[model samples]
Target: MALLIEWKSGGNRFMERCNGALEAEILACVEGIALALHWTMLPFEVETDWLTLTQMLQSREKDLSASAHLVREIRRLIDGDREISARKIHHAQNQYY
Candidate 1:
């Protein structure tokens, strides 16, 4: 599943069932980011709930974990431009009943 939310404009949402582990689904979501946003929309920042992703993106050394390729791809996109930035932010807690 992929989600895109713009401040002023409306957002887009997508859902796709994947036959793999959670890591694989995470990779799918990360990969979809590039396609979700436009190239000309550089100098933009993405606030994420996942602190690990934020750390991975900001890290200089490549992450060689199971999601290495996924992280590497995201790093490539971040490196492709100069003004792009990503940071970890607290997300609202969800209650699972």
Candidate 2:
């Protein structure tokens, strides 16, 4: 899967960068977690280090069409079986309001 970023940086920031290796690794981890959770009928949470990637996967961004495809695959695997969500945290990036 790919990564997506959504940020509100004091309404001044217009630049962004993503760590390709980290994103790929996170996506793989999410996929593995989903597969592991599939055995149980009970719903569970799927957490990731990259919250923006989660949101974008759920929202399915158009500009990042390539990434969207991978997200769609993950969504399909988890479809109707569980609920998935995204959460962002304060990292090196500017604090979001």
lDDT (C-alpha, whole model) for all candidates? 0.59, 0.53
Best-matching candidate per TM-score: 1
Question: In model 2, how large is the Cα lDDT of residue 15?
Answer: 24
Candidate 1, 2-97: lDDT as tens digits: 233433223344646443554553564465466545544535666566777778778898587777777777777666544666776666631122
Question: What's the TM-score of each model vs. the native?
Answer: 0.60, 0.51
lDDT of 2 by residue, 1-97 (tens): 3232232323332325434754573556455556555555555555555766656655744636446555666676667735545455445643447
What is the C-alpha RMSD, rounded to one decimal, of candidate 1?
Answer: 6.9
User: Residue 51 of candidate 2: its Cα lDDT?
Assistant: 64
- At residue 25, candidate 2 shows an lDDT of 37
**Candidate 1: worst-modelled 10 consecutive residues by lDDT:** 1-10
* Candidate 2 accuracy as lDDT: 0.53
